[model samples]
Target: MTDILVSEIMNRLNSLFPSVSSELNSINDYTFLIAVLLSAQTKDKRVNIVTKELFKVASTPVQMLELGLDKLKEYIKTIGLYNNKANNIINLSKILIEQYNAEVPLDRDQLELLPGIGRKSANVILNKICNAPYIAVDTHVARVSKRLEFTKNTKVNKIEEDLYKVIPSEYHTIASNLLVMHGRYTCTAKNPKCSKCILKDICNSRNKYF
Candidate 1:
């Protein structure tokens, strides 16, 4: 798509989702990081359901360590990959306390160094917390970007790179969340609600369901 079309898509997205943000429920920075980590391969609704109880008992790194590994697993067992997630959460919590004084790192490199925090997770943290211009390409973001012709790449990193090049910097921070919301609701993988979509007139996807 041309830059003008991309700009119009962004404008529509911003108008549709004026308050772009994650749906994961978190009380603080520590809980927010943990919520995002636990959200891997899991739905935000599921993550929120588990974290509601998990955070009550262990909202901080020190509290997480005190909660112990096995107990933490019990709380998040309903989530996929709970065993590995529990282990990473514990280990990352230790790193946070020992290295950063129990504070979530604002730097992308430092955040990525934490257990279970990949580029996508780090991008989310940096964008949401630090208000940085980083687009975290999740499944929804990737699908929407491809269908919109914002990118032809299948790899998330490449898609993110394409978005950075295509989307104006002013909308960079909100791009991921906006696209995520759009894909999750309007431009779904199965039978997308193209008729109700703001970009329906412009979108020429084969999957469109009018």
Candidate 2:
């Protein structure tokens, strides 16, 4: 049952968005992790805007530490939770320099130990940088998965487990990208474009709500 649903959604997503990946607009692990952390409760466009400026000044752990929390806060002031995120970034940068030799830890466990890096953020880092088969369940993934009947639970871990069970191993890397795009553009939280959605036939939330 789960496999069938996964196949249906994958097919529809492939047709809708052929090229989908980290639209956070980053090129390296450091930038990617920073972007993901700043993206908490913030939009990709905003994250991109801040990261563009932040990275120019501090792209490495050494540079980040030098920038200091106060300066970092100023740069990312537009993002949500700027104060907390600034502290996390500073602490995480210190950890990276002291423990990991200024390198982003590849191990998910180690990554999670960083101040701002949670399970989802760690998963994003591992999947994007280390090619690990991890699904980071953000708001978009959670909403889309529930609406598509992939899972009835709102718990992020449960949704991730269900997604792994349903989606094919081959598609895991692309699945995150595809689902994120679907949620952002078509299956939005408010006023979803169901009429324009290619998965209108399979999406459980479409006709049932409208």
Candidate 3:
């Protein structure tokens, strides 16, 4: 049953949105990591807005550290939790320079060691930058997974485990992007667009309050 459902979701998502990658506008690892950190509890569009100004001045760990927290905060103040985010970015930058030779660590464990970087953030970095098969369960992924009856578990970790088990190995990375886009545009939190959704027939949450 899980396999059948997974196949259906994969087929529909691929047909609807064929391309799936990080929508962040960044040219380097440092900027990418900063954008990911800023993305927590924030929208990608807003992250792009803040990162554009921040990256223009400081796109490297050394440059960021030299900018100092106060100035950094000033640049990213538009983002939610800007204070904490700025602190984390600064500290993470310092650690990067001291430990990874100013490179975003590819290893999940090493990446998680940095401030503000949790499992989801690490997974996104690995999947997007390293081309690894990791499904990062943000709010969208978790909500959509349960609504689709892909997992009974509400916990983020369990949802991730269920998805990994049900999703085909080839579609893991694409699945993350597809699910995220689906949640953002179709299976929305407030009012889902089920009428226009291609997966409405199979969607367990169709016609139900989102």
Candidate 4:
């Protein structure tokens, strides 16, 4: 799609989904990071349920260590990949305490250094926590981007680059969340609600005209 088309799509998306929200809205930075980590391969709703109890017991790095690995696993065991998630959470807590003085680093690279944190996770933290203008490309965003012809590249980093190049800076954060919410609800994977979709005309997906 042309830059003008991409810009129009973002504008329409921002208008439809006005609020900036995340399923993992932790009270503090420490809990927020843990929530995001636990969210991998799991639904946000599920992650929120687990974190509500998990954070009540341990919201800080030191408290997490005190919670212990085995006990931590017990709390988040219902989540997918709980075993690996538990291990990473514990180790990452230690790293935060020992390296960053138990604070969530704002730098993308620094945040990515933590266990279970990758480019997507780091971008989320930077955008939500640091208020950086970054559009984190998750499964929903990636799928929506491809459908909208934002980029043909399946690689997430390249997709992000393509989005940034076309989308206005003012709509960076809004655009990401908009596409995510759209993909989550209207433009779903298996069966999209194209009839009710505002971007139906602009969408280049195979099912757009269906």
Best by lDDT: 1
Error of 3 at 82 (Å): 0.8
Model 2 TM = 0.95
- The digit string of per-residue lDDT tens for model 1 on 157-185 reads 89989999999999998999999999999
> With candidate 3 superimposed using the best TM-score fit, by how many Å does residue 207's alpha carbon deviate from the native?
3.1
Best by TM-score: 1
Residue 146 in candidate 3, Cα distance off native in Å: 0.8
RMSD of candidate 2 to true structure, Å = 1.3
How does residue 190 of candidate 1 score in lDDT? 88
What digit string (tens of lDDT, one per residue) describes model 3 on residues 102-174?
A: 9999999998889999999999999989889999999998888888888899889999999999888889877
Model 3, runs deviating above 4 Å: none
List pairs with backbone clashes in candidate 1: none
For residues 26-141, could you state the per-residue lDDT of candidate 4 as single tens digits? 88988889988999889999999988898999999999999999999999999999999999999999999999999999899998889999999988888888778899999999
Clashes of each: 0, 0, 0, 0
What local lDDT does model 1 show for residue 138? 97
176, model 1: CA deviation in Å? Answer: 0.3
List runs of model 1 lying over 4 Å from the truth.
Answer: 206-210
* Predicted structure 4: lDDT: 0.87
| TM-score winner between candidates 3 and 4 | 3
Segments in model 4 whose C-alpha atoms lie over 4 Å from true places: 206-209
